[model samples]
Target chain A: MIEIFDLEKRYGFTYAIRDINLKIETGEFIGLIGPNGSGKTTLLKLLFGYCRPTHGHIRINGQPPSPKTNSFITFYPEIDSLYGNMRVFRLIDWYSRFFTDWNKETEKKLIEFFNIPLNKYVRQLSKGFRARLKLLLSLSRDADIFLLDEPLSGIDPASRDKIVSAILREYRENQTIIFSTHIVSEAETLFERTIFLMDGSVILDGKSDDLREKYGKSIDTIFREEMYA
Target chain B: MNTMEFERDRPIFLQIKSAVKERIVRREIKKELPTIRGLAVELGVNPNTVARAYRELETEGIIGSRVGKGTWVIPEALQEIRKEMIEDIIDKFLNNLHSIGLDSKEIKEILEGINDRDI
Candidate 1:
């Protein structure tokens, strides 16, 4: 379980996120949803320990986020951080050597499913393929928690479907996944719980089905009509 | 299995339940239901949602599962599903008419005015 208490982050004079408290249980698939500049990425960065919270704290399985806790968490950043000059197959080899829990079988399956060109350099691949390679690398690890930041952003609809399918295919029953995305319509069905962030604060947090029952609308509709309105 | 497009206004589990019930009624799913994970993947939904739908169906005696054997439609599920479907249709029809300002009296009058020979 992960417990975040009264978390706050600030950059210079501006607050990125403030007064955030969340408790994520094991095996739960959560959506961190918000528009641009709503601190979705900041919140994910804080969770992954890429940056420290200015106030409050986060505990993963009763331990704080650190290099030790990092082993249990697999983070897929929103940016393209792969080695630009390395061939796809070489990059995969280098990445697999870093983790003892890497599953070669999953790597093979994702490579086939995503149709990634192994001979092409990472910089030479299309945006969609780059995103697929990032996802493949993150999902190939056997980690307890997966933090994916906007895995569907800027991709075509067909590639988005393939990404969603790959995510589902690699989903283990015991793993916890918290993915942040504004593409709520396509991904709404995958979220068991959804947290709606607006202006760096959580405006809504509940089970997806309960939210649907309460509002009589899908999460996407609520996100658009209520949160953005 | 074909991808199912969900209506955005209702709870997804309820929608899934109705869809599965419709399939069972239509004999498209005669013997066994797909595994929760399989159905989840096919529908692009969380497996927990599919599991909830299955659990509700089980509670209603529409489906059953054993340890070794997979989940299957109950023998009398067809009759039970038909009764539920009829109730649902009537409830929806009544609600729709009511929403349009028609009371039970007007509904009954309209029903009585329909010519039997129109068939």
Candidate 2:
């Protein structure tokens, strides 16, 4: 469970996001969605303790969202900064050595499931393959809370399907999943609950179905009408 | 214990109503559903939301209320609900396909292809 109270973040002269109060319980597949520069990254960054909130408090399992919280939270950043010079397979081995929860069996299975070549340099892999590699690395951690930022951006249908399927297979019942993406139509399948963020505030946060009924549209359309319009 | 876990894109009141309807459909909760206080505690939501959902379901003839006895499923509601669900599901499906630019002929062809395939 995560409890966020009046969570606020700001830059020197401007506010990124503020007055965010949310409670996420166990076993939630939450979709954190917003436009660019809408504080989605800032919210996620605060969850991982990578960035400090100028004001407010965030607690993961009654404690700060930190390296200690790392045991409970696994994050997949929007960008990949893997050591491009190294062979792809070695990176998995390196992570396995670092995070003890690193499941060798799961990693081995994912390597085959993703069909990622073991011998090629990370830079040599195609864009799709690289994305799968990142997913595999994150899932290998087996944390209870996962914060994924835009895992399906700018990908082909097949690639997107593969990523979605991989997540379905890899997800555990006990974990809480908070996934952020811009793709709206896919929300119906990807998440059961939706959070609407605009200009750094949670304009709409409710069950996906109610939001749809109130506006008589999908979450995407309601968002455009409510916040963007 | 985790209200956020199952939160849908729909309104909170409708979710409460749907939960009661689901239990009725499954026969797990045959008759009068739990009181608002009980459901709110069980699901960890606002009491008012649950009450509102129950009120709406009553108006729809899916459930009934006794002045002092409590609430319950209408005896004939099970059959009526099943009948209602068939048309609603079909309508939503065809409308979705049509909205996506598939014509009636294209939809018929797709349906036929599914039928032709071996189970």
Give interface RMSD, every candidate, in order.
0.9, 9.7
Predicted structure 1, TM vs. truth: 0.91
Candidate 2 is scored at a TM of 0.68
Tell me the spans in candidate 1 whose CA falls farther than 4 Å from its real position: B90-119
Top candidate by lDDT? 1
lDDT of 2: 0.78
Question: What's the lDDT for all of these models?
Answer: 0.91, 0.78
User: Quality of candidate 1's docking, in CAPRI categories?
Assistant: medium
| Model 1 C-alpha lDDT per residue in residues A1-229, reported as the tens digit of each score | 9999999999999999989999999999999999999999998888888999999999999998998888889999998889999999999999999888899999999999999999999999989889999999999999999999999999988889999988887898899999999989989999989999998999999989999999988899999987768
Docking level of model 2? incorrect
User: For candidate 1, lDDT tens digit of each residue in B2-116?
Assistant: 5689886678899899899999988999999998888888999888888899999999999999877999999787998898899989999889999999999999987787765
**Residue pairs with backbone atoms closer than 3 Å in model 1 (clashes):** none
What DockQ values do the models have? Answer: 0.70, 0.11
Estimated TM-score per prediction?
A: 0.91, 0.68
* Isolated chain A TM-score, each model: 0.98, 0.96
Residue by residue across A174-225, what tens digits does model 2's lDDT show?
7788888877665444565788888788988976655667776667777667
Model 1, C-alpha of B64: deviation from truth (Å)? 1.9
